[model samples]
Target: MATLDHILRPLPLLFIIFVISSLHVLPASATSSDKLKTATTIRKVNRKGPYVGLVTVIETEEDAFLASVEFRPDPNHPFIDLSGRRFRIGKIHGKKVMYVRCGRGMVNAAAATQQMIDVFDVKGIVHFGIAGNINNSMSIGDVSIPNQITNAGLWDWLNPDKAEGSDNEAYLDIGNYNVPQSDGNNNMLGSLRYGHEQLYSVNGHISSPQNVFWINTTQEWLHLAADLEKMELLQCVNASLCLPEKPKLVVGLKAATANIFVDNAVYRDFLYDTFEVSSSDMESSAVAMTCVSNGYPVIVIRGLSDLAGAQTGTNAIRKFGSLAAANTARAVLEFIKKLPSNYNVNS
Candidate 1:
């Protein structure tokens, strides 16, 4: 005669009980569409083991990983071999790890993530990349740590004229629009729909007024959430399913953004005046979304890389980018160092 609230008191252990008991409790008698509409809290689990530290850096050059490698020294490194095309393995913080270059796209990022989890045995991933700023509050060197990431570009392609799918097929629902599902996996292909709590927990200014000014409103700035905010997070979240045993995973890091052309005054001015975007580059949103859904912790540390309307802000870009990345990396390392060798956080 336990109430739902009483029964749910120990929710953290639910995942283990569900798995051990092999219970396939259907979605509360609701249809898949209904389930989609409903929000779900991702379960988190932390187990005891030799604490390992990991950091992922998204850089233009292959050598970026090497730079990070020097920071953490491990001779017997764990490697991720992507066949002949990409073979990378290393150790950081004296723990096993892998470094990969997820070529710029959702599919590639998804594939690489899967390989890392499945093959390399990475507990958590830190996606380091760059992203653009759309809020005037941002300066040439500021960092954005987003609490939630929505697929901004997900809904722009609903051409009724081009609707060509089997009548029986269900279109992928990405918030407002439905897109064709190219990936068979549910986690990787669909649009992000974070729970209200998670969305509200995020701190920053998004174009969506609903998601703006949730927690810790330190700075004042506004940025428009664009349509194509990169489709990589879903892929990372999906990759979690592939793990034989789901672990409490964390996806963390920062990103900087600017105009498409690193050095285009016209584009910069357009972004600043119209979008009120601070800086522009690429990648943090994807990383943030993936981390949240996978039931892993994430923290974004960004630095402003460009001015509102500078023709080319490479100088500012490099300085800020490096500063942000360094600080983020240090923070991540510090967090890892704090974890005890016998730390056990229930998932």
Candidate 2:
């Protein structure tokens, strides 16, 4: 009886300890909440300033540009571990720059631009890649530096009944109903939300509000691009092949951005006629909006790989995509060389 009593006395102490441990344990929901809080704190603390941002849309475009410059792995870069994405620190004409492939759409572009602004000290952004030509005058491989960029997908979908008194009997309007009033900072301080119910029949997922607009490229950058001497652009993909004509650089044109990959001639004409856009792409406008929000001046240089369905034969992107990418990279590198090191955004 005495030995049994001794064992039961230790059992009560052990049970008490177990109860205390359970009391200290966090609930699963609370643990998840704490993890989210920790991640948010990390992102806020990782904010960085005062660097040039270079972005491309895909691996091929990124590879083409990287081939032009000697870059090395930035060991201390936080985003280096991300798979299937390219991030490097490189010099173009002796200017230090951060190059990243922003993936291939409006969402990815916006996210990459925001990440650059949040994690790096980006004072200005220079985006370069290939685009579908909206203008018939432009030929394949010609480079276009757009002065203005607009989100072509953001629009007010009006019922036909509501369009009776409108100037044009159109069912769609240019401005979004949910767009916030400008905060007087060049109309760059607003948010864009996807109207999934109005625009699509899929699972209604509304995008978090983001900056979107007809943002203009930095005038200083545009001026620098205008003074650039035409460099020799790639005219052939291989030893036995060559393009019909040499490509020329065109600056100060308008560009439009959409979530859709536009390959239809009717839509191409609409974009040209409505917005006077010389080129159409998937990412530029989103990049511009993010730059505007972060007070980083931005510029876009795109090479024409296709005529946005104006061509009759095989798609130009399939044949001349590499050439277009190379030309844009060359033009951007030249512009970087000419840009003054002491140039200030406020000045």
Candidate 3:
């Protein structure tokens, strides 16, 4: 017969074995094998040059940028359509770059951003466009290089009649929006709101269920953009049309992105009060999220085209969109020249 001490000693070893068997841990070799497969897949793609990818949310923005700088198309491969989106390989300011259009809405923007990154050896990304101004201090045509950004589109819409059930944390109650449907009889509800899109990484780069709230711009790039604070912006759409105030460059604030175009004062106020965001756009946060996830650096430059919903009359984006686009392009060009000739993409 075994002694009591001997039986207890063996129990510890047996317990360790049981725990090890019960855990869903992948074998070390499996992780290594998966990494190898990923690397191989990337290598098989025949990706293009390591270039700084340029993106704009709409065609108007692209037109303005093209007018501001020369983007000579690569002779060998000028452009390609990948997943119903066009990617143009080119050189801007004598530096290799690829341009892609981030169509309206978050889905389009995310798809285009990831497509560019996957199809090309993207070193870094620079996204520029026009947006609605939320900060009262900023005027139309003012360029904003926000230090932080997030997708405020994510929500936990709740039924007004029911008690809140989920244990998840939420911010802001955007209720009283009993808007009648355009065709349907039911009214649209705006009950609750939350920030931060949640995701899990398969590559084990990030912890499981990462709550992405504010995606901070690359510190170095933001610092470089800060140097442009003194840069002058166009105050006039033309000789006949000029903004009441001279536009200026604003830096180090926050911006919000969503699929919905916000042209309501109530919603604009809510965004500013809740997120402290200076500007709102349809695409920036999606691009930022994609680049950050891919282990690359990215920054956004936006020119205020309208006062969201606080304007005295109709939206000013259409009237001043061209001016705002041109101003944003100017800022991007200046920012590009500030980049070091040889930069570590990872850095």
Candidate 4:
């Protein structure tokens, strides 16, 4: 309720306020977004970083590294918290590294990856965790290192198929508030929907929508990981429970990501036949996208913890998740050991 004269009576105070505002003490909103991108490739990121980042989606996933790898926490800077994630800086397997748990879901995964690249000297990223199996041929406890990852969460739930028998790639005909009956299968049974997250990098500062379906991983890392196909994986979850056969490593398959936990057999089969993906997880695609945008090398190692929605009887994820994570950890360790000391994490 002060008049202009009264408000301006404190001339020195107003001058100080003006000075502080003029100095721009508060950071601009774009400051953080500006940091979203850096080098676009491992070669550009530099050879100086001893760290090859290890990213996980959950605590159990991080346990995979904790069980097998010897992590020497960074002596000077042991940990960093950014975007609600604590990045543990360390050296594993005698190689410099920073490990961080990205938590679950696509947003957390993407944020963690961006923070890891922007906040540290991250040369490459190796994301490992457990996932639902899409390929029935592959059993629980086996690991899959796919060549590509994609986000299937982007969607357009269309107006119901008003014109019946429309040749849509996916159309669940549920008309007029109808509760479509399940054909003993958890089919989509609803309106048609589209998916595939959009983003094609025109450059570091710009990404345009391209409607692309896949995010390819670093070819160099994928070829190197190919050797792991022969490595043995953990088969037994203790004495009583064991996988039917020795868990195997299968490489070069495609994997997918979505916020949704896929557990419907009908949708699972649809994903399998449509996308040709071998595994589905909640995080990998976001990590892959972030890495790709930053021009860094990235690969995801996933343990098959459940058969997506196709598992018979009870879902085994709760029982075998740790086992799968451990196998993936072993695979990551082997991959690290195989890297030449001179590789410099792609410096």
Model 1 lDDT per residue over 107-155, tens place: 4554455444433333555554444444444443234444334332222
Residue-level error in angstroms, candidate 2, position 332 = 1.5
lDDT of 3: 0.76
Give one digit per residue, the lDDT tens place, for model 2 in 241-307. Answer: 6788888898899998888777887678877876789999999988887776556789999999888
- lDDT for each candidate structure: 0.36, 0.69, 0.76, 0.74
Model 4 RMSD vs true structure: 9.9
Residue 136 in model 1: lDDT = 46
User: Model 4: per-residue lDDT, tens digit, 61-91?
Assistant: 7876777646667665666544457777666
Better of 1 and 3 by lDDT: 3
Question: What is the Cα-based lDDT of residue 209 in candidate 4?
Answer: 58
Q: Deviation in angstroms for 282 in model 4?
A: 0.4
| TM-score, per-candidate, Cα-based | 0.43, 0.70, 0.78, 0.77
User: Which ten contiguous residues of candidate 3 have the minimum total lDDT?
Assistant: 37-46
Backbone N/Cα/C clashes per model? 29, 3, 0, 5
* Backbone clashes counted, model 1: 29
What TM-score quantifies how close candidate 1 is to the native fold? 0.43
